[model samples]
Target: MASAHHSRKPSGRASLPRRTTKGPLDAVDDPSLASSRHSPLPQPPQDEASGSTAQQSANPQPSIQHAQQPSVQVGEPIKEERELSFLFDTSIYHPLSQLEVPGPFRKPFLPPPTNETSVARSLEQLDALLSQCEFLRAAHLAGSILTSGTVRPTDSKTVFRLLAVRYSCLELSGNLLLAAQEAKALEDLSSAFYYDDPNVDKAEDDEVLQPHRVPHHIMPFSLRLQALRLQSIGFSDPRRGVSTLYDTAFECREHLSTPSTTPEQRVLWTERLHEVSIWVVNALIEMGDLDCAARTLETIKPGNSEHRALWTSRMILVRIKMGDMAKAHKLMKDSEFTPEDKLALESLLAVADGRYKEASEALSKSEAKADPSMTALVKQNLAVAYLYQGEVPKAKSLLEELINDGHSFQTLTINLATIYDLTSDRSRDLKMSMISQIAGLQKDQGQSRAFVNADFKM
Candidate 1:
């Protein structure tokens, strides 16, 4: 059975808004629109005045808090903003050694080509490597491209996009420490340095500084979020991610407030605001501050049925986590959840109250399974309920099936390993066999966390 720490929550499979543009480059070329939150490339220009420094906004460091923008007259020339030096740093690149990779996962390697085609070709190679679960190779190739001098510092959009890819590769390869350290090279993402605007002095007022105009954020939404997450985990500062989420929410608000903002952009910004707000609550909950999470959840206004469903679901989970079953029940009862959602909530409540059989039965209903992305989560939870009901063999078989079906998430793998310990004296062999199978399986995308030795309890 999965322990309380490992229990799966009904996330409702929340996702950022889809990009309308083909790629980050397309978003960059269009200055009037903000890129969708889910875009892999750097977001287009946001309001420069509204951009909040990561350190100041996240933690209120005194130096950054007291920093001031240059005072400018209507026609005064805007002195060139300080150049972002890290964009040119070559030391960030490092050779990828097979010895650095975990022994079981290592394979034969080839150094990526060093030529004009390297950066473009390496990006394709990076995608292919990640799909093949060759994360180390991808990480190395990304580093090589970053330092190859093919990507110019003047081309901030391209640089930012590649940085995001490099950061993602390091993170997905189980190199969180390196990822965090490497992220430092980005410096303060919200600094004026990233928002170079030659027209700023020509603007008579902040109205001209609206989000719909030129000069959007240089860093994409995903990279900014990733940077904060890494900072929180790498620095052991729990509040950093929460703070960053709030900054994102604030930025979204700024975009929504601009009168010139397109109807479509406004809709995207509003959706992003709601998503970031939910992320804040989730971060707080993960930090074990359920009271703060609940309070934060109360302030987010859902724009539609889908968002309302997400808010309602998250609130109930937080209340249950706080051991306030009556509050959770009341919240669930008061809301008009879809039949599927209501059934899922009832199952959650049942599990919390130790009624494993009831929870299992509720989750079994076809009406309770709606979101395809959430199916694996539901099945995993059902397996845990079976274990709690003393159906050990059933639980084991269910978890094994999940792995075989290409869903060897870390928590599921650990639970399976735990089951192996209970069912056999040769748990190590079973774990080794499972690891081999998992290592051989190709991942479809970056959604799954990278495999680590510790996940098998080795």
Candidate 2:
């Protein structure tokens, strides 16, 4: 929900050699991808019957055959110009049966346009659908446009943007598995084949490569981040996620270290590196490599005191999760965390130590609410502390108030449903009523209004 100021370019200056970090995801170590950077991908073995047809179809440009002429040998420049534009297969637009989506979210109240001709209008409609939290419909429409064979092949920016939207909507609408499956289309995105470097020959002479010489052609950095995560999850390979994130971080670092990088680019790459490091830490944590996660956390140096304090607080929590309570306490004592962060840490420590009343008191402090970002988290913790202190009614009332105020967080809804099950014989009716009330809530044009049945713990 927060805005990122980083440049969305897919690749940093290609001449900057990717630096490898000792982290959980070692993408540079993958033989399959590492070997791809220097050479063209091996063409699949083809039979005589279908190879020519496939090749011709693959390159719709008539001039594609010029490279095969006798005069145009390997390493020789062809006289004719070739269209190297990339296009997605039409198969990606296959009809998505409504039966595939969850029943409750299958049909949107406002249907998406099916035969829109204008790309601009279709893009507008897609944004409107997403704003209304009509994710499934948005996903369908996005997929249609992306794979419609209508967008110009050279317009990589728009193509990847739509891809990101389609994947994002699918995941947000609770079709994570489907989104992951679709992510396989983005294999080896870091391969040099995707990039167009007109000045690539100069690299052989050890010349200073200008950034503008290598324009980005791969998916936007944001989409690449999400896609890599999705691919790793879908393929059941957590290490892949870690490695790819490390690879991206390496690229960011390379950009930061380059003297030719503009001040704007330096700042953007710095932020991107920080974000990538955070993702690497998360991937490490998910992989149950807590020590690696801690090591990775230390590599991130935030630009501001506020960010530093936030990261230190996270490090303290990681230490706690690693069962090093003494280290967690010592880190907290040694660091200069903001008052809000300190209160949050203290409450977390108290909860871990079974001091629910103390935790509640700390979270109830005005300082705990100083940061709007921390407010919901503090309230959630307070509710948990209330429940631990045997004040179920108070906790229930607080959660209900949060819900009534339009904080439709899944945890809040599920916790409220659990309380209903504990206190009432007709909990199902209560949950259904809650769902109905949520459905009736007025959603703003650009706000997410989608809700799934699972949010109520059904």
Candidate 3:
């Protein structure tokens, strides 16, 4: 009775149609059924006025759109930066053209040789110029030879010869520093050749097929001797200078006696020996070593009239310094000298003998008018005579004249200072000023205190 009542109630509500649910197999077989089950529900048409309101409800903030706009702008710059980076990077690796590529480093260019005979001809020309005393031309020619790059090891002899001659030329031309450098090069070459065949004995016979002989120590020694002499004279150290001169003299003598010395070399050594002996004697005299000077002079036999005169004059001067006026007068009479020289010597002897009037008369009578040096010497001696005679005014006048004439000798300058000390009535300040001037002159002439003292005693 309950089931019949329920069914009668459902029929009374309305004679409703039966609703059917589709199975999976039916849905798969029917596209319309599958589409209807999967599709979204249909919505009612929205008015324009309500569309914005719905969109605003869906997204309440404008931050997302603002953020996205900035990201787009920022991304554009990032892309441009990436492109620029790629351009620079690729350009470094791959140049656009061959001209844009860097070239390899290269050395500086030196000029090529002008001709094969250029060096030889230049050397010959230099020799000719030097023989003619044309040192400037010779210097230029030597420079060309050195710069030519033709000085091979095989041509060392020629190159070394040129170097030696070049050094001499430069030295004579007053290029001391450059000459010293050249001389050092020659010394090095000499040392190298000396050790090249140290064990081998030098051949005695020129007829035999001999090894190349080097002028072992002589060349370097001579160069050093000349250098020492120059330094001594330039720097004013006669004691050391004279000692070195003596040493060089002994060496030259020893070298001359050696059996290895050839006739030509002997001639050169003898000449050098004589020259060094003369220097030794002079240096000894300058240093007040009269005994040594006399001994050294005894060893030096003069070769010519010029040498004889020179040695005799030096001997007379030494004897005069020793207060042996009798021997000085004897030497003056025996030696053949010019009229002016004899007069000068006589005046010196007269001064030593205390004959001031005779010395003054002899100095005044000297006819050395054409020679400025001799005139200056006469004036100096005359001034000395005047000082000895107590004629201070005359002595002062002569000294002042010499000073005005620019007499550069140390003796003259020292004498002037002595006269100033003895004769001047000026204040200490004036005397000091005059002394300073004389001192400056001494310094300019490279005079040492010992030299001045010696000159003063003389």
Candidate 4:
């Protein structure tokens, strides 16, 4: 019984694609590939002609647009070209975070690391190899260190040095994007200036991770994820403070792209890629592009049981949106799911037929009482069920319970406020963004004629 605003459409579960090396990252890294669109040729390269060449001698001048190769022409169809370039393969680890393999996937997809006799020896070997290779090799060496899994809280400097060298290479080559991605991974895997010591004056005056300046290792991946989310929802301009995040994401992609192209490197990159997918889905939903969200899910291959169920459940939401119950059920036939899972899914489908009782009964019979956060989610759904059954008090109780538990960041807040018209308890200093969002949903539901951010009224 979730609130009406948070409820699902009557469509059956969606069937998402499997997780192959060529999945969403391929699409995400280059969005142009996602479409059936085409693009004009790339602008000329800066070094196309040198001083001794006749062409260079005659021209004596490279046009401004040539100087700025990928200029943002107002009406030109650069979208597809940009998209394709964006989705270019990193050739790193084919990430496994999005979909679980049915059987245990213990195989090292990456080139197995050279076995070391001891942790200290592995560190020594990594250090010795450092001065002999390029930045990517250095980054690759860092991966080897991680693959060894012994680079402890103490080896932070070693990891940082490796990434610094790798980023330096990208900077030299004018590939800032890839540099940013690698820098981010370095930051996440090892961050410093944590709020742990005494006599450190950890207040705002001495705060480390400030906006104008950011320690390299932490900025990149988070910003990439944030930018992807913003782009998913069609927000061309994110607010002011997020510029660093944008730069980091753009740079990180470039920094990591070359090194990750090797088969072994792709294997190591999976965990971070999975994280990116989850964030992308969230952003897509906010932008209300359900089908595009489904498109992104195409990368999650369901080659085995665990993977099948995980992806099936995700697609089930899509099918619900698509309103294809038969296909949804068909997708789950071989999934070997439990009776409770089936019931919850069926009840989810029943929401379309306006059968609130059956759906609620199905969910209630399942074991959703174990985890507190999950329990809160179920309660939200139950609230929707109650509302559907025309049981106002029951639904209201569940909604109130959710608010008390403090999950005001989702549709949970938006839907309830829409239904109540006015709630007994009001949020103090509510965000204009959230309020404006609720107002839009209200208008869409034919409940209000007022606009939120824009003044357009229906």
Candidate 5:
């Protein structure tokens, strides 16, 4: 059989007999295996093979389960892969290429240059404006220049002075809160430039040897003192304001006496001291410290006719308040007062001496060309005169006008009550009503007294 098995291949087509090795189906023929070996394994249908190749190219990563599944049925993974590719191509890839990077920070604008001539011209203009009492315009101009940042640091004294003037203007304009803020800024700037250690002794031991040395400390000190004075006034602390003015006056006197000071500088400081002394005296008189006001006035020797007139006027007013009518009259006679001031003083004297008709005539004569504040004051004094002279109707008309014009309700109510009390029993109810109104007004004003005890002569 082995020889026959070998010899069977010699024929063109030969049949081989199968041998049974074991029990069950070992003799069965495997015709499919034989055909697989003879042919090329019946290459998968051409279209199906090409589809599989294309699906694999679309998604390089193929899972075993995915490979086993048919391509048409496995649609979710292919859609997801296409969407992810689209998003990556749109936003995530090369993101920075489309943006613009910013450069370093720089100032948007620069201020104009300030030269000495320009600064002087501006200061001259400011002075002219101040002299003309164009305070708002001056303040606006100064503020613009200050905020422009064009002034040199070494030449900041002029700017500070302008700022001081601006604060004064604000105070005069009745913007007390804004004035206080500006005063604080001036104080800070002065301190930054000129503050010295208080614990250190600044007194010179050999004053004669340094007589020729220029005193550089006066300007900044003056500015700081003025700022403090303005701040105190704005806060309604008149005593503190007066004290600060006194300090400034003393400092100016000392600076004026410095042997190294130029003639021009001496004149400037002397005038400043005089002005500050006048303010001190005025503040003392306002506080009813008559003795102090007199003492302060005596310290200032008048150097000009105008100053003499001012001094005389203040002294006369003080004497009038102290009930020294003879001395007040003597001073008024001796003083060369302007016609308006003379009229005001005469009216005050008449009011003090119970000459209501004379006082009313003087006030009316003076009211022809007065400012609004002065007019109000004249009206108030005239009403008081009428009330005292048994002219209840005229007093009532003036008081009602004042109340309608939003003057002090407490004052008007008190005056009305006084007038009603002096009248007949026909106005007894009206008197009670006026008294009640006075009480309410006082309560609203937070005044401790029912009637203001201040003398209204001025």
Candidate 6:
């Protein structure tokens, strides 16, 4: 980990867009992320829900809502305020970059926080904006990485930020394109994206690796980017996208695997636990490989208290969804899941038994202990649980608060919105208006990645 302490330069200044070019140091080259002595490889930022939610509520797609907020008559003024802020943010993009992208990317500051709390803190205003097109973004990204110096993060802040940049880029452009197109040209032009310069391998033994340059996760990401870009540009296929992701997953698992067995295995075990426990399960679910992912749970379960409980709980959710209550119960008992996970497990069981009251109570207990996020998740689940119990408003209210969090978990949001629709007795127009706010919340949060990008130099 390296600390990124670039000379306190002004971030997100309004500069005329740099002309994107092909070839070395152009659209593809990124200086901010690279290697040191041609090193190891890489990683998605988070688990956004898909198009379905177990919970339903009235909601509209926020993308549609964003354009209409200013004129809305019924919604909260906060949304209107956010609209103003978003437009201001959007305006900066017009004057800054020749390459178009979402305004947030061009701004030195991150996207505006959806919740009201952050507005009081130092939310630096945006200056530069980017176009939303994929190719220009791709080109800009290549150049940014090259000029940014691909430096190793010496601290947690930089590491998180480095990871964020990697995550953000992949989120926006995780597809491949025709090798001959401008986007492809941008992809091909990036030397930094190459895990390593082949010529480096052939350089005279005396000609050592550069002083502070080596591709870390850069190469793996580059490989995926090329593949993903192709997918983005009408490649007429998903096979490549799926293939690249799994390959990347394999590489990630390999990079994370331990070499030897010893007491150190304990530490390695925990690290691996965090990887699969916190991310792999959810990531797999998002990728629609839940069944394949479930098999990996056995390996992921390790000798740690929190992770062990989280792992067991996650499996219980899978089993519940799979309708395998028997195994879910057995594991629940065997793992002796913590109070929270146990409650999650029990709630699922209660739901099947038509014990709605028991399910709600159990879910409440589980949710009581969750952090704001886990609490929100529990709340979203509560919406479903309530719907199961025929308690629609309880479910609706639970989702409404969750909408405040505006999680991008595609499934969670969709499920919540849909459930609200099913459960609510309100008129169609009223429901749509309310649900649309939640959607906007999700959209706002998605654009504003929480991973603070800290610049790090070796």
Question: What tens digits encode model 4's per-residue C-alpha lDDT throughout 407-455?
Answer: 4423466446544543333432233334555445544554422112111
- Residue 256, candidate 6: Cα error in Å is 8.0
The lDDT for every candidate, in the order shown, is 0.58, 0.59, 0.47, 0.39, 0.46, 0.39
Off by over 4 Å in 4: 1-219, 231-266, 274-296, 338-343, 367-373, 401-419, 422-458
The regions of model 3 sitting more than 4 angstroms off are: 1-208, 211-215, 218-223, 226-247, 250-267, 282-289, 367-370, 406-409, 425-428, 431-458
* Candidate 2 Cα deviation (angstroms), residue 425: 3.5
Scored by lDDT, model 4 comes in at 0.39
Backbone clash total for model 2 is 2
TM-score of 2: 0.73
Clash count per candidate: 6, 2, 0, 54, 0, 67
Query: Better model by lDDT, 1 or 4?
Result: 1
- Poorest 10 consecutive residues by lDDT, candidate 6: 58-67
Model 2 Cα lDDT, one tens digit per residue, 1-458: 01132232223323334546663222223232222212211121111111111122111110101111111111112222312222255443344555543343456433443444667877888878876667767778888776554566556656766777777777665677777777765555566645444455556545634542332334456667777887888789999887778777666555545455555555455555555666677678778999978876766544345455656666776787788888888988888965766776787777777788998898799334657754664576678778888899998898788778767655677778888988889999888877766655534322356556666766
Cα lDDT of candidate 3 equals 0.47
Q: Give each model a TM-score.
A: 0.71, 0.73, 0.45, 0.38, 0.45, 0.45
Regions of candidate 5 where Cα sits further than 4 Å from its true position: 1-158, 188-192, 195-214, 217-226, 234-243, 286-288, 301-307, 321-327, 333-341, 363-458
lDDT for residue 98 in candidate 3, whole number 0-100: 18
Cα RMSD, model 6: 16.6
Best by lDDT: 2
Question: Cα RMSD for candidate 2?
Answer: 14.8
Across residues 1-458, which tens digit of lDDT does each residue of candidate 5 receive?
01221232212332222222221101112232221111110011111111111112111111112111111110011111111111111111111110111111111222222543376676676666666444444555565555444444335445556555655554333344665544533332222123222213335665544553322332443345446655665567878766556555554554545555555555455445544555566567656788777665655545446346655655665676678899878887777767766777777778778898998788788777456665665576678777667777897788767654545533455555566556656555665444455445545665422122211100
- lDDT of model 4 at residue 236? 41
What's the C-alpha lDDT at position 366 in model 5? Answer: 71
Which regions of candidate 2 deviate over 4 angstroms? 1-116, 201-217, 301-306, 366-377, 443-448
Candidate 1 worst ten-residue window by lDDT = 61-70
